[model samples]
Target: MRRIIYDVAVSRDGFIAGSNGDVSIFPHTGDHVDAYNERLATYDTVIMGRHTYEFAYQYGLPAGAKAYPHMRHLIFSEGVQLPADAEVEAVRADFTTHISALKKEQGGDIYLCGGGMFAGLLATSKLIDVLRLKVAPVLCGVGTPLFANVSERIDLKCISSTLHESGVEYCEFNLQ
Candidate 1:
């Protein structure tokens, strides 16, 4: 089964973005970005909430564009509009049902490009297999959080941790 990886960047204070949804604070230079770019090859599908999908505006991805060019992009949105031939696809199938089907498919892993709420939902449901976190040293006191309002504490077993030169700590945690 393909694992669902919540591979995300986080601030030291646990926020994924600034209060205005700006993720520019994280270190975009050096080994952190290089390692992240390399990690992208492990995923064939990129799953995200509508906001995260649309958030690509900062990267110049228009409404009809795909969030990640090579991967299968699935956005969970009830009311997002897109062109018929758009590279991105909205989630028309049932959430758990579709995800369960995806897990059974023979392919590379799927990534949960998060926006907090959606990741929280999956976390609570025990759908998130592993969390690949790149923790930036800076803190966003108030912002879109890394994990928001989860029902219970999902214990994590650390798989590995590496400290990068840019003060970023990359860690892999599997849910237990």
Candidate 2:
């Protein structure tokens, strides 16, 4: 079975993005850049919440545009419609069920691209297999926290960690 990895950049305070869905606070470069890209290349599918996709509005993707031509993109929303020609498909309300079916398909691991709320739901449901992160130095006092709305404790076992000169730490953990 394939695993779902929440491989994303995070703040010291555990936020995925700043308040109001601002994600510009995280640093972009470090020695970990290569490893980050490597992780991206490992997944054949990228998962994103509606808000997360909209956050990258600067890089406008018109209808029929393949955001990641090399990989499949899955956006979760209730009934929001995408452009008729958009390459991506909006997932149905039965997200968890559909996700399970995706996992059973022949493919590499899945990447949970963004949205703390979406990650929280996955974590809450005990569906996430890996919690992988790049910890940046910035501190967002108020922001969308990693694992937001997850009230219960989810234990994790650290698998490995690498600290870079830029003060960014690359870490991976397995759900316990």
Candidate 3:
């Protein structure tokens, strides 16, 4: 089965973004970023919530456009409307059913792009297979959490960890 990998950057306090969806505290350029961009190349599919997809608008990503051009995009949002000819797919299907079917499909891996609520849903459903987190040095104190609305704990086994010179620590984990 293809794995759904939740790859994201988190603050020391465990926030994916600051209040108002600020991400300026995270590193924008460095060896760690280079590694992340390289890893992005390996994924053939991506899935994310509407908020995460729309967040790219500030960075000039056109609405309905694929955030990662080379990968197939699936945005999970019930009321989200996209252009008729949009390259990405807006999925209003049942989350568990859709994700389960996607996992059975042939693919390298599905990149769960960034969304605390979405990640939490997948984690609680035991659907997420892997987690790759880049822990930043700063703390947001209060912001969007790493996993929001999780109803139960999901145990994980550390697969690998790397400390970059930029003080960013990359950690990989698998559901246990």
Each candidate's TM vs. the true structure? 0.96, 0.94, 0.98
> Which candidate comes out best when scored by TM-score?
3
| 41-105: candidate 2 lDDT, tens digit per residue | 78899888887776666678654345667789898888556788788888968888888888889
lDDT of 3 by residue, 127-146 (tens): 99999999999989989999
Clash pairs, candidate 2, are 64-85
Model 1: runs farther than 4 Å from truth? none
Q: C-alpha displacement of 100 in model 1, angstroms?
A: 1.4
**RMSD to true structure for each model, in Å:** 1.1, 1.4, 0.8
> Which ranges in model 3 have alpha carbons more than 4 Å from their true place?
none
On a 0 to 100 scale, what is the lDDT of residue 51 in model 1?
A: 82
lDDT of 1 by residue, 1-176 (tens): 89999999999899999889988888889798899989898789999888887788778888878767789988887877888888888886587777888889999999899879889988887889999999999988999988788867789999999999989999999998
- Compared with the true structure, the alpha-carbon lDDT of candidate 2 equals 0.84
The order by descending lDDT is 3, 1, 2
Best by lDDT: 3
What clash pairs does model 3 have?
none
Residue 90's lDDT within candidate 1 is 88
Ranking by TM-score: 3, 1, 2
